[model samples]
Target chain A: MNVLEIRGLSVDYLSAGGTVHAVDDVSLDLRRGEILGLAGESGSGKSTLAHAIGRLLRPPAMITAGSVVYHRKDEQVDVLKLAPKALRAFRWKELAVVFQSAMNSLNPVMAVGAQIDDVLRIHEPDMSRKARGERVVELLRRVGISADRRKSYPHELSGGMRQRAAIAIALALNPEVIVMDEPTTALDVVVQRDILHEIRTLKDEYGFAVIFITHDLSLLMEISDRIAIMYAGRVVETGTAKELHRSPRHPYTLGLLRSFPKLRGPREDLLGIPGTPPDLRDLPPGCAFHPRCQSAFDDCGRVSPRLLPGPHGEVACLLNENTGVEVQA
Target chain B: MRFLARRLGFYLLTAWAAVTLNFLIPRMMPGDPVDLLVARLKGNVDPAAIEAMKQAFGISDANLWVQYVDYLGNLFNGELGRSITFFPTEVTTIITGALPWTVGLVGVATLISYLLGTLLGVLAAWKRGSWLDGVLPVSTFMHAVPYFWVALALVFVFGVTLRWFPVSRAYGLDVVPAWDGPFVSSVLYHAALPAITIVIASMADRILGMRNVMVTTLGEDYVVMAEAKGLTSRRVMWAYAARNAILPNITSFALSLGFVVGGSVLTEIVFSYPGIGSMLLKAVENEDFPLMQGIFLVISLAVLVANFLADLAYVVLDPRTRQEA
Candidate 1:
């Protein structure tokens, strides 16, 4: 069953210059208990799409057109259509998110347990303080931090521990979907590996869908069940992680994969994408990626390709058609 | 606790610097205070009487180091000496008598203003780009307007034009000193104009300040995290945004507490309310060196002590600062 469905979602940021089409004509679905990696470069509107899922974007950024229908338990509610009161209840109990800079996300002044209890106090105020304390301890233990650390402040914990604490807070309500935006970006490689492992174990144990958004394609490939490649505010490709690794169809996707320094490979220089993603405010016409695409034909500059199915994965590249100029690299 | 001790030590050093400057600045001035006072009292006093007065005022032929040591010694024992203007009244006595009036008047006013300002700020931030945003520019302009000017305007409108309350003084002469309803009411009635002036004067800046802080904190990723966690907007505002935003204001408020002893000189002068500001002004005009030095010492100490408490409060309010220290 589809846990979350985003249909033709478009987000526009109303800046001083003009309306910036941050997320343009994006649509995707997350199945129950599946980890979907939403991969993109810095200006690709990946985080904007994630924020839109929860109706979290504020002006001058707005959801211009979209329907984010989120399914919690059995019933479904269009997140945008929900009234203020309904929306309040809908968060945490149904969906939770671990934001970027998870360490700073925790209040510096408040103790860890009190902060967690505050979550319960807001969402489930009827729970007695003692009961909440017990639950917090259990939650802390599950996240591999000492229960006593609950009395400590956010500053008291290391970066990795803080991330775990944030994850624990996200899971406190046991929501069906947990959206993580670069959760391990600040941690060391070993710590990042540990956090990813913990996340995999937690997802398996809790049985929740994950919309993991990150710029690290290799990290996404390791854990995601399926991957969606976003460029210039649109999803260019979507496939099983294994299929994306073995064979990438889109030019942008192939370039992104090749850019990463592979641990298993012989010593070789990394190939970074030649230019930055197109500016959303003054985006180029036709295919947004065409300017950056190496195998661009005349048609590629004139016609924008929608995400279409090809041999290995869904591809948005015009070159993937019967012309057969294999860019397997 | 060690951090608190460290802060206390730092404050003491600051106070020592302040007191040192206090002792030095008076001596640095061109005219001798004793000679000036003698010149003023030529008709009523003899040369021997002038010498005796100077001796009482600690202007004997002692070394600068000895005088400094005596000044420090006198401060510890609460021996602020007598005021020249308010003859034979010790500086300590005047300050103590005036302290309660300022506390009851400005302290309560400040409390009321802070609460009202913070609430308005929160609401204005939450309801951004509405009529409330229009209120911000106006309040910010009001905040920029000087405190004395605001007090004068309030007096003009409420006292001169309307004649609703007393123009000056804490209580009416007919009210008597019974602490009864009439006395209480009269004091409040007279206080109302100044209180309102002070509140209106401080509220705007605090509102704008808190609004800016709230807006910034509300945009923080944690606030979004809190919102995503099913917390209501009110919860997110108060629990997450307001809690963090109020830290700077809290420190500012703590520092303001020290100023309570000095009183707003212009506000007191306008109303002729016999507070520390009025007393300090007279001392400055008369060049009563000891009185001036004493008042400065008190003000600096109050500021230091309040700041110390503020540092302690940071630990209580923000656990992260506690860990870091």
Candidate 2:
């Protein structure tokens, strides 16, 4: 069952220059109890999509179109249409978000324990202060942080610890879905590995879906149950992690795979994607990735390729156009 | 503890420099207090009596070093010499008599303005493009207008035209200085126009400053994080954003509090209130060296103390500062 169904979502930023279509008609699904990794380069609008789904985008960046339907056991909620009060209640209780930079995200003036307890205080008003304090301790301990570190401020904690605290806060209400936008981007490799491991363990224990957004395809392959690759504000391909790793149908996905260095493989020159992403304000004609795609054909520059079902999963490239599958434009 | 000790040592050094400057400034001025005193008497007193009067007032033909030593000694011994404007009255007594009025009127007004202005600022920034944001510019313009001008305008409208409040003085002359209701009410009634002027004039800067700071603070990741945590908009504004945005405003508040001892000079003059600002003006006009020095010393000390208190508040409020300490 899909926990979140995002359809034809579009977000535009009204800048001084013009209205930049930051997140052009994009669509994807986050399944129940699954880690759906959203992999994309900078300016691809992955973060914007994540924020749009959460209804967290500020003005100047508005949802131009589409619906975000949050599916629970007995009801379906169109998240974008929720009133301010209802939105407040819907967030954290149903969907919590962990931001990119943990150090910057946690309030420097507040203690970690108090920050986590604040969530409990708001959602569970009946809980006693003593009980809240104990829950905070348990939450901290669950995140592999010592109970005593609860009193420490964000600046007092190491980067990894702060990230863990952020995750702890996300888990405070035991929300069904947690959206993490590059939660480990700012941490060192070892710390990143540890945090990712902790997240996997916690997710298994809590049985919650996660939309993990990052630009690192390698990292996504390690943890995500399913991986979705986004390009120029649209998802170009999505498949089971193992299938996507073994045989990526989209040329852009293949380019992304080639860009990263492998730990153990035959010695070969690393080739990064040659050209930068198309400007959202003035994208090139036809397929947005055609300019940067290495294996572009005649139709690739004239006709935009729609997402079509491929043997692996779904691919949005002209290479799979005539594969006798239903196309979704 | 060491950080506190270092801060204390720094304040003490500043106090010494301030006191030294205070002692030197009046002496450097062209005229002498003794001459001013003697001229006021219109040469009616004998020359010998003049010398004796000068001696009594702690002015002598002794070396400059000797006078400096005596000044420092007198300062340490709590003797601020005599006030030439109000002869036979000690400088300390004159200052003490007016301190409460300035502290009560200006201090209360400043605090009220800060509280009210900050609250308005937070709301305005949180709801930018709203009606409150529209009024912010007018408040900023009001702040930019001189306090004395505001005081005078308030006096003209409320005191003169409306006949609602007294234009001049801290209290009605008919009321005795007592803790009784009538006396207190009279003081408050007289102080209303001046207090309102100060609040109106000072509020704009606080509001504008807080609004700008809040706009930036609201952009901070922690505030966004707070919002993402599903906290109410109120909690995001007050607990997350305002708590941090208010730090810079706190420093400004302390500086304003420090100036409260010196009082709003022009505002006091416009209102003719018996506060330290009016007293300082009189001291300068009469060249009352001891009184001028005393007022300067008190103002400097108040500033230093307020600054130290602000630092202490920073330590308490910001964990980052505590870690650095």
Candidate 3:
């Protein structure tokens, strides 16, 4: 069942010069208890989309036209239309965001427990202070921190500990959806694996859909139920994580998977997608990805491929026409 | 605490150096201050009376080192010595009499100005491209206009033309010298022009300083975290951004406090206010060595102590400072 559905969303950033179409027309969904990994390079607007769903997008980054409908209890509610008080009430209780650079996200002055307690106080104002503290301690323990360390300031914790504290804060309200934006980007490989394991365990125990945005496709393959590849503010491809891993259709997706340095394989030199992404403001012709696509043609330059039905998945590529089976669906 | 003790020791040593310089600079001048005073007084001063006055003033030197030692010894005992210009009055009494006026006037005004400027600066930063940005340029213009010039203009408009407040002096001559409501009100009323002039001149730089800091701080990943957590704009503004932005402003406020005794010479002169600045001016005009030395010592000491307190305040203001500590 779809837990979060984003439709016809386009976010424009207002600057001194003019509006920057940061996120062009895009739509996607997150299934209940499923991890939807949205993969993209920097400036691909994946972060903007993630921020938009959480209603965390600040001024100058206007959500021009779209609906971010969150499904809870079989009822669809547009998040953008919520009043300030209603939005805040919904935010921590029903939706939480584990932002990028999670290590630095914890308040330096406040203790980990107090920060978690703050979320509880804001969201569950009815909870007694003592009860809130107990819950926070329990949350911290679940996230793998010693209960006593809850009183310690954020600086007392290591980078991994801080990330854990941030995650714990997000989990404080037991929200239906948790938006993890590069949550493990700042952690070491071993810690990243450990945190991801903890998250998987937490998801199993508590059950919240996650919209995970990251650059690491390999990492996404390990955890995400499905994956979406974004380029120049649009989803180029998306499918079940297993299907996308085995038979990726979009060249950019294939290129990205090939680019990952495999440790055990008899590897040819890792193939990197040549040329930088086209400037979003000055996108070349029709396809933003055409300049980087090795299999570009006149038609590729004239038309932007939608993420249409393909074999076992959705893929946006001009080459899909020649590959008839994937296109027929 | 040990580190703090070491810092305190170093500050005290530097302040001692200042006090020593305070004593020496005046005495080292080309002519004897006593001789100059006597010459100015011309035959009204007897040779015997002059000698007696010199001895009493601590200028009848046994030796340079001996005099220096005595000077330091006297300073330890709170003997700033009497001001020759304001004859028969101790320097300590004069400073005590003048300090409350300067502190009451400039201190309150500076506090209000700094707080107002910092708050406005934070507001401007939060709404970066709005009309609030326009405020800084006007404030900067006011700041750029010399303190004396602003003072003169205020005195001209408010003092000479409007007659809203007294043109000069802190209190009316008819009022008995007590900290009563009318006296206090009169002092505040008369001080309004100079206080405002100082506020206008200094507040812009403070606003600009805080605005720059706030703008930089707003970009920190933690602020993004706060925003992502759905904190209200005001909470994010005050609790997060303003808390960090106000640290530098607090230090600036402390420095302004340190210089409170020095007063703004131009503003003091413009209003003929009986603050230290005007007193120092008169001392300079008369070459009152002891008075100059005493005032300079007090000003320097105030500055050093204020800076020390500012450094201590850093731990409270910025968590980073405490975490590192």
Candidate 4:
């Protein structure tokens, strides 16, 4: 069962310089209680796509065209069409987001516990003060923070603990879908692995689906059931972790795979992608990755390939047109 | 608690330095108050009369150190000495008479300005790019305008032309001075114009300070996190954005509180309001050493106390400060 469906979503940032197509037309789905990893470089619009799902993007960054349909047991909600008041209620109770740099995302002036309780106080008002207090303690405890640290401010907590606090706040209402955008990007490797392990534990306990976005493909491969690679604001390829590891058809995905060094295997030189991404405001005609692709040929510069799905999963490249068997764009 | 003690210790040292400067400044000035008084008489004055007057003024030739010790001792005993401007009337008595007027007028006006401006600022940032943002340019202009000009403009339009409010003094001369309702009402009636001028001239600072910070804070990751938590707009706006935005404003408020105690000299002088500002002017003109020292001492001490209070407030409002000790 699908928990969320994003169809033909596009996001643009309007500035005096020009309108930046931050998130070009994209589509994907979040299955019930599954981890969906979105891998991309900084400007690939993965974060923008995540924010658009929750309708959390600020002004100047508008959704030019899209439909974010959130599926509940009884009905489907068109998130972009919800009114302002309904939108407020729909956010945390229906969908929660662990924003990038979650460590610095807790209010500095407020106690971490109060921040978590605030979500409950608003969405679950029928709960008593004592009940809410107990819930906050439990939330903190689940995140491995002691009850006494509840009164401590964000500055007093270590970076790892703050990130956990942010995640705990997102899980306060236990919504069906949680969007975590680079949730561990700010922490060191040691703490990052520890938190990632805890997240897996918590995910099993809560049974909530996650849309995790990150630029580190290696990290995503470790936890994601399926991985989607984005480039120039478009998803270039997507497949099961095992399928992508076995054979990456998209040249961009091939380069991304080789960008990271392998510790377990014999030493090999990291082959990073050749050039930077094209500017969103002025993308060249044809395949956006043609200029950087090592296998670019005459047709690669003349045709813009669409993401085609087949038995091998999805790949958006002109070279894969003749790969055969039931391919659909 | 240890942080508070450190903070308090800093204030105490500041007070001592302020009092010392207050004592040294007038003594360093060109002529003694006694000479100025005798010069005003414009006749052959008896040397005995001058000597007697010098003794009464707390001036002595027993060496500068001896006089310094005497001044410190007298300050402890609450013996600020008699004012040359109103000789035989205690300097302490003259100051006490003016403190209430200044406190009432400037303090209340600053309060009204800060509250009204800060509230509008938060609203403007919350509904950013809305009509409420119209306040930004207006506040910028008001903040740039000469403060006294705003006062005079109000005086001309409202007091002189429309004849709406009383233009001068703290209260009407016809009213008997007392704690009765009528007298209190009369005081308020006359204070209206001056208070309005203060608000108009000064409210812009509070508005811009708050609005700009609020706009910056609204961009913070935490505010966005709060919204994503599905908290109401009100909860996210106040507790997350405004609460943090208000920290910078608190320090500004405390410093402005010091300004209230220091008294607005132009506001006092323009309306002939009898506050410390006017008294300080008189003391300087007459070289009333005791009165000058007394006013200086009050202004500096008030500033130190106000800053101390701001520091104390930070410890409560921000855990970062409390972590210092």
Candidate 5:
């Protein structure tokens, strides 16, 4: 069963000059106990999508239109429509997000343990202090941090450890889905591997789903059951990790896969994407990716394409239609 | 603990330097305190009385270094010499008599302004588009107006015209100054206008200061994380945002507390209140070197003490400050 059902969600950053279309008409699903990898380049709105899921977008960056239905057991609630009181309960209880750059995620003044304990105390007001204290230690240990490190502030811990502490806080209330936005980007490769391993082990043990958002496609390929490629604030492709890797349909996804050098393959120079992502404030008339696409035609510049169903998954490029490989969904 | 000792040592050095400046500046000026005293006496005093007056005021043929030693010795012994402004009265005695009223009235008034302003500023920043934004312009106006204008306006409106409060003095003319209720009420009644003036004039800086900082910290990642953690708005505001934002304000607050020893001179003068401020003015006007030096010493020491206290508070408030401790 799907834990989170997101449909046609759009986020716009309203500024003095003009509105920046950050996230536009994106829809996805997170099944129970599965890692759904959200892959994109830097300005592809990966973090925006994650923030939108929790309704954590601040002023300027507003949800122009969207509906995020969080399903738990038999109950369903549109996260966007929750009242302030219900919204407070909805966050960290049903959906917790570990933000990008862990150095800034946790409060610098508060102790690591105190920050973790905050989530528990707020969500479970009637939980005893002793019980909360014990849970903090357990959570810390679960994330591969020593119990003694609890008293240390965010600065006191290593970068990887700080990220782990953030995860521990997210895992405090045992939420059904955890949205991790570049949670391991700040750490070294070895530490990142360790954290990803810990996350997988914990997910296996707890059976909680994870929406992992990152620009690192290789890491996503290693961990994700299914992968969604976002381009210019919209998901351009969606497929299983192996299927997308072996035979990616989207041209943008193909360029991304080609950008990363394979360890075992014959030596070949990397071909990074030709141009930067489009200006979010003033996007192209039809297809945002057409200017950079090698296969762009007259029709490609005049019309946007929807994600059409295929054998592996779906692709939004009109090439699939021209080739007569798949029909529109 | 080491950091505390280090800080304490630094303050002691500053305190010594302040005391030396206090002792030197008054003497460096052209006129002598003995001359001022003799002029006050109107030539009636004899040469012998003049010598005695000079001796009482610590004027002697001793070299500057020896006199400095003597002054330091007198300070260590807690004897601040006689006040020329209030002749025959010990400077220490005069300060002791005046300090309680200043501390009780101006100190508490300034504190109230800080607390109320900071609270309102936090609310204003938290509710950016709410009616609390209306409080911002008023804070700016209060900040812009001169302290004395507010004091005089309040005195005219609340005291002279309205006849709601006493026109002058720290207490009623008929009420005995004591630890009793009637005397205390009279003191508070008289202080109301001056206190309101002080608050109105000063609270703006704090409100503006705190609001600017709160606006900045409210956008910090930690505050967002706190909110995402399902914590209440109050906890997110005070604990995560306001707590951090208040750090800079706390330093200024401590400095203001130190300035409380100097008292609100203009306000005190306008209200004719019995406080250190009026005495300080009188001392300056009379060129009462001993009293001026004494008041200056107290103010400097209070400032040093306040800075030390602020350092202690920072160590408690920000965990990073304890790194060297």
Candidate 6:
């Protein structure tokens, strides 16, 4: 069963120039107890989509049209319809977020332990202070941080430790879904690997689903159960990690996969996708990726493609139109 | 500990410089205090008696270096010399008499303005583009008005038109200043207009400054993290954003507090309030060198002390600074 379902979600940023379609008509599902990797480059709207789902977007960015339904065992909640009071309760307890700069996300003035305790104080107000302190210790331990280090401020801890503390805070209430937006991006490779491994272990132990958003497709391939490739505010492809890795159906997905170097496979020159992501305010007429797509045909620039299911998963491209596969609406 | 010692050393150096400047400024002026005294007495006195009076007032012709040494020696001994305007009365006594009125009136008013302004600033920033933000222009306009103008306006409106508060003096003439309720109430009642003027004139800067700092602080990732933690809006604002935003305002408040001893000169003059500001103005007008030096000394020392306290506060409030020190 799907833990969170997003339908036709469109987020627009009302800037001085014009309305920038940051996240346009994107739909996807996060299944229970699974890691759904959202892979994209910078400015691909992956983070924007995550923020919109969590209702954390500030001014200039608004959810123009979307429906985020969080499915639970006994009830379903239309997340967009929640009142301010309910929204506060709904966040962290039902859906928590680990931001991109998780290292800097912890309050600098506050100790890590107190920050975790704060979450407990808000969500589980009935819990005694002693109990909250104990829970903080447990949460810290689960994230591979020593209890003694809890008194340290954010700057006192190393980059990796701060990220762990952030994860600990996210897990303070044991939310069913955790949306980690590039949680390990700022850390070194070794620390990133350790954090990713720790996250996978915790997910297995706690039975909570994760929507991991990052631009590193290789890291996602190593950890995610399923992967979705976002290009210029739209998911160009979605498939099982193994399937996407072995044979990516979308050209954009193939380009992303080729961008990263393989350790053991036949060595080839790294081929980065040409041109930058299109400006959201003034995108191309059709197929936002067509400007950079190498295999673009005559019709690719004139006709936009719907997400059609090919043999592997779903692909949004004119090339997949004649593949004799049913389109998944 | 070494950091604190270093900071103390810095303040001591600053105080020395300030005292030296205070001593030099009055001496640098063209006219002698004795000449002004003689001018006040007219040409009727004998030259010998005038010379005797000059020596008595410690304004006798001597080497500049010898006079400087005497000035420092008298300062160390806590003898501020005799005031030329109020002859035979020591400068210390005159200043001390007026010090309390200024400290009580301006000090309380400044503290009130800082607190109220900071609170409103946090609110305005937290709810940007709200009604509070809309009112900011009016506050800024009030702040831009001249201090004396505001004082006069308050006096005209509250004291003259409404006939509510006393337009002049620190207290009613009938009531002698005492620890008793009636005397204190009368003093406070008279101080109301002047206090309100100072608060109104000063509050705008605090509000605008704090709001600017808060608007920037609200964009910090930790504040967003706090909000994402599902903390209430109030906690996120006061505990997270305001806590950090208030650091800059504390320094400004300390500087303003230091100026409290100096008092609001224009406001005091307009109200005819017996504060240090009015006393200082009288000393300047009368060319009372000792009195002028004493008042400037008090203001400079207060400023130095306030800055030192602000440094100490920064060390306590910001862990980042603590680590650096």
DockQ leader: 4
> Which pairs of residues collide in candidate 2?
none
Off by over 4 Å in 6: A323-329, B28-31, B39-52, B59-70
Off by over 4 Å in 4: A322-329
For residues B193-252, write the lDDT of model 4, one tens digit per residue: 999999988889998899889999998989888888877789889998999999999999
lDDT of 2 by residue, A211-231 (tens): 999998978999999999998
* Native RMSD of candidate 5 (Å): 2.3
- Interface root-mean-square deviation of model 3 in angstroms is 2.0
Which regions of candidate 3 deviate over 4 angstroms?
Answer: A16-19, A263-268, A322-329, B42-46, B129-134
- Kindly report the docking quality category of candidate 4: medium
Q: Taking the tens digit of each residue's C-alpha lDDT, what string does model 5 give over A1-329?
A: 89999999999999998998899999998899999999989889999999888878889799988799999788999999999999999999888888888889889899999998888888898999999999999999999899999999988888999999999998999889999999998899999999999899999988889999988887898899999999999999999999988888887887887788765658867776789999898899777899988777788898898887887788898878666543211
Report, in order, each candidate's fnat: 0.80, 0.79, 0.43, 0.82, 0.77, 0.68
Report interface Cα RMSD per prediction. 1.2, 0.8, 2.0, 1.0, 0.8, 1.1
Q: Which ten contiguous residues of candidate 6 chain B have the minimum total lDDT?
A: B316-325
Q: How many pairs of residues collide in each model?
A: 0, 0, 0, 0, 0, 0
lDDT by residue for model 3 (B94-140), tens: 88888777777777778878888888889999999888889878977
Clashes of 2: 0
In the predicted model 3, the residue pairs found to clash are none
DockQ of 5: 0.74
**Best of the candidates, TM-score:** 4
Model 5 chain A TM-score equals: 0.96
Worst lDDT run of 10 residues, candidate 6 chain A, spans A320-329
Model 6, A1-329: lDDT tens per residue?
A: 99999999999999999999999999999999999999999999999999888888888789999799999899999898899999899899989999888656887788899999988998998999899989999999999899998888888888998899999999999999999999998999999989999999999998899999999998899999999999889999999999998878788888888899875679978887999989989999879999998888778788898998777778898878855432221
lDDT for B53 in candidate 1 is: 80
RMSD in Å for all candidates: 2.0, 2.5, 2.6, 2.2, 2.3, 2.7
List, residue by residue over B36-125, the lDDT tens digit for candidate 6: 777888867889988887877787467888988998898899988889889889999999899988988999999999998999889999
lDDT of 4 by residue, A1-329 (tens): 99899999999999998999999989998899989999988899999999898888999999999899988899998999999888888888878988778655888888889998888888888999999999999999998999999998888988899999988888899888889999999999999999899888898999989999998887888888899999999999999877887678888887887888764667867898888988899887899989988877787788898999957678898878754322221
| DockQ comparisons of all candidates to the true complex | 0.77, 0.77, 0.53, 0.79, 0.74, 0.69
Angstrom error of the Cα, residue B44, model 5: value is 6.3
